[model samples]
Each structure stands twice: as structure tokens, then as C-alpha cells.
Target: MVLLDVEGMKCGGCVRAVERTLQDQPGVQEASVNLVTRSAWLRLDPAALDPQQALEGALEALRSRGFSAQPRQSGVLSANAEPDRAWGWWNQWRQLMVALVLLLLSVLGHLAEAGTLSLPLIGTLPFHAGLATVALFGPGRSILRSGWAAAISGVPSMDTLVSLGVGSAYIASVVALVWPAVGWPCFFNEPVMLLGFVLLGRFLEERARRRTGRALKELAALQPSSARLVMADGSVRDVPVEMLRPGERIELLAGDRIPVDGVIEEGYSAVDLSSLTGEPLPVDAGPGTELSSGCLNLEATLVMEVRRVGRETALARIISLVEQAQARRAPIQGLADRVAGRFCYGVVSLALFTFLFWWLIGSSLWPQVLEVPVVLMDHGHGHGVHQSLGAAAQTPFGLGLQLAIAVLVVACPCALGLATPTVITVSSGLAARQGWLFRGGDVIERSAEIERVVFDKTGTLTLGRPLVEAVLMSDDPSRTIQLAASLEQTSRHPLAHALLQEAQRLNLPLLPVQDSRTVPGAGMEGTLADAPDPLRVGSLEWLRSQGVEWPAHQRDAVEAAQTGGQSLVAVSLGHRPIGLVAIDDRLRPDAVTALQRLRSQGLSLGMLSGDRRQAVERVGQTLGIQTDEMAWQLLPDQKLERLECWRQSQPVAMVGDGINDAPALAAADLGIAVGTGTQIAQDTADLVLMGDRLEALPEALGLARRTMRKIRQNLIWAFGYNLIALPVAAGVLLPGFGILLSPPLAALLMALSSVSVVVNALSLRLP
Candidate 1:
């Protein structure tokens, strides 16, 4: 995927044009353009095109469409680099100031004509005409140029409507001034007012739009551009963060943001992770504590070995995911896009129809409209004509033209285009700050619809770190543990760690074993070098399958252990029962509260695990899960099958944190992976709880539902505003109540429509 900063996109039409241009390029699988971010994300086929070539081609294509495009830098933020000035706030402010000056001059000319004030040459028609001309060619130049370019390229946007509205008013005024014999009215102030309102509205709209992306900007700001590198001789040198590589040590000072994801090698401190995980309190860090980039070291200095840098850092990944999520269009947005794609063309046609209707039939039906004395003019000595409206009624063309300009300027396509993406962007960023990384808008939508949440037994609901609770041995307990530890030391299974910890606690030395192998969902086996028979340590079923007989007296003890939620591992030496090791895993501190929250949200909960039924049952009862909702003694494939069955009834979200849960996670409607899970599980899941806090599950779902609701509200407002405002602007209420929307007033309303949508989306940032 590649991100490109695109300039000169003014509305939904521009988004469609850019997307179409990029999609037409070879090897480009998909292209998504965001008006709010002013960026395009392209998914390319690596096999079909080189990365450099594809970028150049895309840039060239955008340039041909009269847009500026550049590849976005993916490196750590560089303080020395200049900020983006393509659409700088200062530039917008300058344009708005120019329009304001022109508008004030035109308004003064009208005041002079009304005998309310007297000025030297301000009241003159020629002066007002020149002011309007300056406004059009100065502050409004970009609008005209971009509109013309879009029209030439067969993709007109909101700019096209504004340009046409302002240009038509200016031309009609010029014709009236040049030829008074035509009986037309000269109103130069109309054009100046229209341009001024558009410029002012856009300035305000841009400010609100920028605020919607505050979360992403805050996250980006947390990345430190430089780090203190510790040389081999124990001296520290300041260097760029990008220059640091794996295995290199970096020294972090107090109150400094961590520059890389790594483990603490020396010293200790209380680091502030609130910026990354939204945790209120700082967490203590010591030697061997894993630290992620973008966290703040609150006290004391520490040295950390760089494990991941650049885009590989946790902060970078979160930023990238947020960007992708914002760029991804929601499924519900398809209807809006389809409507906005051709909205300008339809608006232009409606403007033409409005002109023809008012000119041919409406003016004849209500001739009094022309006699309302709206036209203002200035003769040589500050003398004004209040009779121009009546005189211009004979022509009727000027009256129709004025109404048509209102129709053109009042229709807005930007609101519809921005409604969905702005909300998605805000919601994604909000979720990220809370430690939930939603992959895309589609994921957010699906997550909101979840009816059931099925969680894996170990590692997901429980802490997953089991401890050696008891040890029963037929011979010597120390000898049995030593033999088992030798074979288990080579495995990374949770049970292996438990046994190793116990061996270390007892200070027991392990015996060497040969040809050790592990069976999935079963156990481990190896041959002792000193013994002729093979040694085994696994589930009771696995031992019995290997012809190892369990003593009648031990059956009662093992049953009691299993029934008590303790997992028993049978030990044997060549068909001879050695002993039993009972391991027990505790539930996660937040599991009970998280599950209860989910259930309260009208979602059914279930648990699936490969552990013994008795053990799974004990956990299910503690969590309030019914017997029918719990499944145990299952393999990886069985978990997938069970998840599928649950999904058949309703959309199910599967949460897991082990390699064994990857299949089920991928198969579910929505896959939520624990942040501490295996890389494969995280990769296959749709949403990842980056903080590994189960309590965030309910919050994530609630945020998704709220985002979707915001989207619906925005869509309704966008569509409703256009539906009602268009007819009013076209003079639908003129014949009934003599109410006609002027060009400037229409322009203001159009701007407000878009601003309202964006502001509504920004509300998601609020509490």
C-alpha cells in the first residue's frame, strides 16, 4: 500500500476523479481517496509493477487532472523537514482577507446608493464593477481555474458551481453596464458578495475539517525524531532515531518519549503509557521490561536495546492502521458516493432548468417579482434608479439569471462526500487511543453488528500462565520432576513453562533425554539416556494410547484433580505409571467484568477450549457461561467448526490469543486478537486489543455502534439539506410567499451544510 498527498481536491467529485485516475493505472488493485485527509491510499500488485514506477505513474496521472501529488514520507518525523505548505492556513487566510476587502467595498457602494452614506467614487457603478472584477480574478482565481479544469476533464466539482454562479453574475452586470439600451439591471455587488461568502465559508469549513483529525495528529506528535545511542565504550551520542538498528542500546532521559520498541537493558523508571494505551497511571519499568515506542519515561534514566524501529514500531503501526481505517470507505457510504459522483452535473442541469422556468413561465405568472425594486444603480452625481427592476422586467432575462445563480451556488456535494469518512476517521483514532486497533471501516461496521462473542479458554479469558499446583509421584518426586523438565525445556507450551518454573524453584537438575518430540493437543515424549524405556509426559488419554497403564488407586486422585479445574499431566516410563502433575491457570483479572459488560449489551457469550471438560466447566461457571455455551476437549479444527456453528445463527466475534485460535479467529465474522498473542493470531484477526485489556472489548464495541449512528445522522442531514435547500434556492417558495434565496445567502448555506457534517463527526471526539 502507498499513501499520496493529493492537492486541489475540493469535494466528492474530486475524490472520484482521483480514485478513477489511479485505478486506471496498471497493477493498481484499488484506490481510496479521502477529502478530509486530502490523501489517497493505493493497493498495488507487487508482481505486476515496480514500486517506484507505480508512484511516478500515479503522480503523473494526478498532475494531468490539475492536481499536485507527492509520496508521503513513512520515516520517523523529522524536525528539520519543512511542514506541508500546499494548503497552509496562512494561504487560506490571505485569500479570505482579499475577498473580505472586496465585499466591504461593494457593500459601501450599495450604502452610498441608498443615500445612507456618501463616498467619493465608491457609489459609482464602474467602481463597483472593478471591485467585483478584482475579487473574481484575485481571491476567486483558484476557484475559477480549478472549476474550468474539472469541467475540461469531464468531472466538475463544487468549485464548478461556485465559479459559474459568480462568473454569470459578473458577466450579466458587465453586459448591463455596456449596453443600457437592453433595459437590463447592473448589480456588480452580487458577484463580489457571492465570492466573499464562498471564501469565508470554506475557511471556516477547513478549520473544522482539520479538527476532525486531531487524534491522528496527536499520535504522530508522540514519535520522537531523535534518540541517544550508547556506543560500545559506554558513551552516549545523540543521533536520528532512524539511524538506530536492532541490538543497539539507546539511553532515555527522564520525561523523554521512548524512541523505539525494545526491552529495558539497564536502570529503572516509571513510564507514562497514557499516550499510547489511554491508561491513567504510569507503569513501572525495570530491567527486562518490554517498552513500546511513543511512551514517556517519567522518572529516572534507562537504557533500552532497540528491538524494532521506523515503521515496525508499535506507534508507527497504530498510526498506519488509523490512516488505513480512515481511508477505507464504509459499506453504507456506497449510496452517498454514487449520489455525489454525479451531483454537480445534476445541479448544473437543475440551474439551467431553473433559469428556463423563471424566464419562460414563472416571470409571466408573477410579473410583480420584477417590480419589487431590487435593482440598485448610480448615475454620475450619486443619483440611483429605483425604477430599474420595473424596467428590467421587460427583459426578464436578468431576473431569471439571478435566480439561476442561486440554484448553482446553493447545491453542495461536499457534505455527502465527507459524511461517512470523517466519522470513520474520528472513531478509528478514538479507538486507537483506547488500545483497540480497528483494521478498517468494514471491521467497525461488522463489529457493531456482533450478536455473540466466543472466547478461547486459555490466554484469552485466563491469564494463560499456569503454575505447578501439585505433584504426585510413585517414586521420588524430585527425580520425576527432573526427568519431565528435561523433555519440556525444549517446548514453549504454557505447561512447559510451569514445569520449568517449578524445577527452578526446587533447584532440581534435569536429566538429559534423546529424540524428544511433541504431539499437538496431546503431549511430549523422549527416551532417557540412562534408561532402556522411553519417558512420557502428557494428557492421560495420550499415555493410555501409548499403552501406559494408570494405577487403580491413582484414578480417584486424578478424577478429583480434573473435577477441581486442575489439568493433570500423566507421567510414565515405558508402560510404567510414574506420577501426575496438576497445573492450574487463573482467570484474567478483567475477564468477569468484561464478559458481564458484553452480555449486558445483548450479546450471547461462549467459550471454546481444548482443555478437559471438567476444567472448562469450572471456568464457565465462574464466568456465568451456561453449559451449552461452553465446549471443551476440542482440537484447533474443532474450535473452528464450533465457531462456524455459532456464526450460522448470528454474527459472532471470536476472541483468542494463541496459535491454535488463529483458524477460528480468521473464520469468525469479526476476529479480535489479544495484543499479547502470537504474531500469527494478531495477523489473522480483524481487531487487536493492543493493551491486552479484556475490559476494552465492550468499549470498542460501544464506540463502533456510536460511530455508525453518527454516520447515519450525517447522511440524513446531508441528503435532507440538499433536498430542501435546492428547491428553495430555485425559487420554489417565490410564487407562494415571495421568498427567494439570493446567491450570497445560498453560498453561506452550502458551506454550512458541509461544516455541519464535519462538526457532527468531530463530536465523536467528545466524551
Candidate 2:
């Protein structure tokens, strides 16, 4: 699927060599070469060889054969897909060298003829003509072999035409030289000059092809050469990272990258997490915290147990995805493949038609047609009413040459083959650099059409870590706040962190309470260090058992907070009820601005959270998510079901972080998981936001839209190139307009068409 412009292909032999190299790969099922077009098509499996790898294999094969190829850039090759072509510079250099030698000999022969000086015996020879033939037959022999084969097979291609025309002209000159009676005009110099010029074009083409293939090379350059291996028994040994296996330990020195994704078993240091998660901030890592490859070790030596190896690593997986995307054949490339297939058949038909048409109309129709030997000699140049038919109108080689040239020039499927892959490759590479990895081209494309954004409440829209908003008081504020914060500090709950954070922020002096006991659903109880009473914070039933009076006003405040969806903390001192503290969770700083941008893009934002109704409403209102439009206190499964229900009429995207949210994330047409969310949630989601910012969501959607537009543009150009070139190559306009396209002109146009498609795809950079 990788589009490449290869050069150095001069004949069928060269084509076969390149094809063999690609077919050797396990994933490459087939490879087709159009010798006339100087292009090769490869179909591969993403599971085996990725696009970057495939491209490298193809380019190296061409180079080994003395041809240099590159991927064509958009506009530089095709407006849609670029032609996998090679520069003609190598051929040009060889031709130039030949021409210089030939020119020197021609001048020497001219001088020897004048007898200005006595020349050596070697100088007496006709070196000009001899050297000219050598240049045409040696390095440039591939064109001759391919062209001769087509003409003899009667399935003449561009090669057959150019070869016949040039060969006929050369042989005619030789015939005249030997016989001196069949006065055939001498155009020997033209063939020699044409050979030189053609090689120049080929060399230039080969160089361009080589340049375009650099995308894969650049991608492969990202992996490091070796890894630091941490052995057992506390000793460290250096080993090649590729040789390391799963379950092995790797020690990362300061400034080294974490070689594999693993947990820090025993170490503490400020580590740079930028490469793995795209988070620029350095995070402190200690025992039990996991890390991925490419994360830099900044402060301390650490041990990381290897969890994945080689291609199984996260960085390796990302690289694989991008490579596969580049090599993938979209529907657009198939059109080009079909057109080139048809064009191959069409050219052969035209060659036969040209040969037959002349036989039918000529005066010596029977004798001249039957007389192969005589026709081969004089080319049936007998004066019979000055018969003008087909090749007879020009030379015997003229009509067939033109037809073959048309086929070769018009049948290049470079434009069709290159359009989509080139754009995808370049864009995907850039995306990887930016830390936004797209799973596939189609996902990137579909993201552009999103009209509404749905955020999962717990881990997506909010910080997931609930922080205490305010502590409302009724009777005894100290007993209420202190008891609530202290009990939470001993528990392992998200709400506990919120309570502890609130206490720390307010600088509340923590009491040295003893025998602290948790009541599960009710709350907790403990004895204060200097007080005679045991304090208790629990439900009303628990308070009632303790003989505490539930004041109507305190009950009213608790009820109001509960109705508003806030969790209430009830306090009791000795056997009597005290004041209560009502705490609520707040929103993250970036949520409002991101939601506002999504709204501007014509999206109606809604939230689905398991948090209490009042807590959900507070966040929803703060971020402009309509309170009426929200679904509060929703379980993970319920959230998924709600999204499915909403999808009956429109596309729905669910964003979440909790394990409960996994099913919902999977059920949504597009599921976006926050990086801070649980592992299972990220695994279930279609896209993972690697950073804390939700704003990247809108940008990703925008990139998807641009990618789709570019794909469409490339498809159009791919189809359009063939639509216009096919009929013209078939000589459809010749009878009416007398406008027959020359072989070279057709070749140039075919190449230009592919370049146009590639260039069009590159325009994804716009907007």
C-alpha cells in the first residue's frame, strides 16, 4: 500500500528483480510491474510488514539494482497520490558520459578525414558510429530489450514503439552504409541523442522517488540502539534492548529513556513522562507506579521490570499503527489499479489495428501483405498509386511506434496508486510527533463530522478526584469538620481524599484521636485525645442510638444539601448531636473553556456521572452543560444504555475513566477515554487523550475532518486522471481533431497525473 516512485527500472529484467525482492517478504502477496510506466505495485498485509518497513524493502531493492527511487510528494508528483518513481539523473549522467565520448570521436573522425595530421591506425576507424552504437546498446540496453520484446510479441507498448522507431532509424542508416543503393535517410545521431536524453529523465525520476521514501526511514530512526539491562542480585549489565525479554529488569540511569513499559519496583525520582503520555510535566515515581518506554529518567537510578518487548511495546505499537495506515489501500487506489490493467489491454489492441488498417487499404494489399521478405527489405515502398496507409504514410516503424508510445505514456497508474497513501503517511507521522495517535485513517476521517460531545462525569469532565468545596456548619463546627476529616483520612475512598484535602487546605489542626472505628455505610467513631466524650459522625439512625437530639434546623440543612445532590457529614459529641458539614466537589480548571469551544463547533454537551445529582448539576452548570440535559447518578452500564438509546437518531461519543465506564465506552460509536482514567476504560475507548487537556478532543475532530477532505480530493484526482487519459491514449480524438499524442508526451502526462494526485493529498496541511 505504500506508494513509491522507483527508478533504475530499465527493462522487464529490472522489473522482475524488484518484484522478486518484495515477494520475498511474508506479507507481500503480489507485485506487478509496468515496464513502460517504470512503476511497480505491491499489495501487503499490515499484520506482517508495516508500511514503513515495506517502503524500505522496496526502495532498498531498487537501489541494489542500481536504480534509486523515492516517494513522490503531493503536487510534486500527483495532485492526489504521488507516483512511486525514480530520478533519471543516473541515466542522465551515463548518457552524458556516452555523448561526450561520442562527440569527441565524431570530432576526431572529422579531423582524420581532413588529413590535417597523420592519425594512428585506431583513429582510421569509424569511431563516431561505432561509439554511438555502443552507448545505445550498453547501459541503455534495457530499453532496447523491453521494446523489442513487445514489438515481436505484437503486443507493442511504449517501449516497443520507442525501440522500433529508434532501432528502425539506426538499422536503416546501417543498411544505407553497407548497400549504398537503398538511400535511407540518416537519423543515427537522433537515436544516440534520444537515448542520452531519456536516461537523463530516468535519473531525475529515480532521485525524486528516493526522496519521497524518506518518511519511513525517518520513522524507523526513532528507536534507540541499545538498552541498559538490570540483572538480578542487584547487579546491572548493559545489553541490547532488542535482545531483552519480558519479566527481565532494566535499570534506567539518569537521563536515559525507560526501555520498556514496566513498574518501578524500588526507586523514587522525578521522571519525565513527556514521551509516553505527552504530559510535559515531570511526575514523581516510586514503588508500584508503572512507566512506559521513551519516558526519561531525570533524577535517580531505577529498576523497571520489563513487561513488553520489541514490537509489543507501546511505542512499537504506535509506530506499527502509523506504518500500517500509510500502507493501507483505500477504495481510491483500486480505481487506479483497474485503470492501469485496462490500459495495458487497450494499447495492444491499437497496435494490431494500426498494422491491419494499412494492409486493407494499400494498392499491393495482397502481395505487399504476403511478401514479408520484400516488405522487410524495402518496407513495400513500391510506387503503386502512391498508396498512403498507416505506417506507409510515414515509415514502417512509425505507426506501431506511436501506438506503443501512447500506451506506455498513458498507462502509468502512479496518480491512482499514490494519492491516499502518501497523505496518510505524512499526516500520520506528524500526528505521532504531536502525541495524538489515530487508530486508523477512517477514524481520523469520521472524527471531523461530530456534532455533539458527551463527557463522562467521574473521570472525564471533572478531575475524578473530588475536592471539598465548602463545609457548612450548624451547631458545633469543630466537632463536625474535625470528625468528618479525621474519619475520611483513615478510609480508602475518593471522598476521603476530598475530605483530607479540605482539612489540609484550611490548616485544621488534626486531633490525636484513639481507637478510631469505621461504621461502613453509617460513618466512624473515636475518642478525642483530651475530651471526656467519644465523638461520632454517622447517619441519623446511628445518632439516634447514641441518644443524640436531631435538631430540626440541622436536619433541614442536611436535607437541603442532600436534595441538592451533595454528600452530608453528620457529627455527634458524647450522646448528643452537633453541627453538620456539607461538602461538594468542584470542576477542573480547563473543563469550562473546552466545553465552550465544543459548543462553538455546534456541539450540545451533556454529562453522565455516578456522583450525586446535586454534585453533577454543580459541575454541569459550571461548564455550561445543561442541568436538564444531564443524566446524574448513572451506573456504568446505564450510561452505556443511555448512549445507545441516544444513538438511534444521531452519533454518540462516550468519554469516561472508571472500570464501570468500560462497557459504556465500548458501546458508544466513538469512545474517548481520559488518560487519568482506569486502564480498562482506556482499553475500551476508541481514542485515548494522552494528556489532561480535554481541548485536544476538538482539535482531533478538526484534524479528522481535514483528513477526510484530503482523501476525497485525492480520490477525485485519481479517477479523473484515468478518465481523461484513457480515451486520448486510445486515439479517440485522432480522426476528428488529428491530435495524436506522442509517446513521450503521453509518458509525461501520465507522470504528471500521478504527481497531481499526491500533491492534492499533501494539501491536508491547509486549514
TM-score of 2: 0.68
Candidate 1 lDDT by residue in tens digits, 1-767: 87777889988888878888999998788888888888888888888999778878889989998888887764233233335543477888999999999888877787787778888887788888899889989999989998988899888999999989888878877887888877667767777877888888888888888787778878888887799999999999999988999999999999899988999999989998877776667888999999988999999999999999888888877787777777777788878877888899999999899889888988899877765533322112213431221123345676778778888989999999999888998898788778777878889999999999999988889887898877875567777777778889899998899999999999998888899999889989999888889889999889999998767877787667656778788788899988888888878888999999998999999999998887899899999999999899999888888888988889999998836687898899999887543244237888888665789899999999999999999999999999998998777876666566666777888888988998999999878
After TM-score superposition, what is the CA distance of residue 50 in candidate 2 from its true location, in Å? 23
For model 2, residues 641-715, the per-residue Cα lDDT tens digits are 778777787777777763567787777777777664324422576666666767767766766666767767866
RMSD (Å) per prediction: 5.5, 9.7
TM accuracy, model 1: 0.86
Q: Ten-residue segment with the worst summed lDDT in candidate 1?
A: 374-383
